[model samples]
Target: MPDIKCSVTECEYNSDVKCGAPMIQVDHNNVPKSNNSDQTKCDTFRAKG
Candidate 1:
């Protein structure tokens, strides 16, 4: 797969500044639609144990 960069160090799916998941889900943080990066969230994020 192409390199998918990620900066969430606390996520279990993050690997060396990249995403190791087969796929990632990005959803709007609250509103129905997102107009910017800050308005969105990584739904696939899982805290490292």
Candidate 2:
């Protein structure tokens, strides 16, 4: 599969390349549930091993 580049630096799943999971699911609390990109943040992100 092609690499999925993630912009979240703090997420353990985030490397220089793609997310470890085949697909990533972010919780609404960790990431904002709105249209505003500036208000979004993922505090619960973890690397899938």
- Every model: Cα RMSD to truth: 1.0, 4.4
For model 1, the superposed segments whose C-alpha errors exceed 4 Å read none
**lDDT values of the candidates?**
0.92, 0.59
Return the top candidate by lDDT. 1
User: What does candidate 2 score on TM?
Assistant: 0.39
- lDDT (tens digit, per residue) of candidate 1 on 1-49: 6788999989999889999999888899998988999999999999999
Alpha-carbon RMSD, candidate 1 = 1.0
How close is every model to the real structure, measured as TM-score?
A: 0.88, 0.39
Clashes of each: 0, 0
Error of 2 at 4 (Å): 1.2
Which residue ranges in model 2 land beyond 4 Å of their true spot?
26-44, 47-49
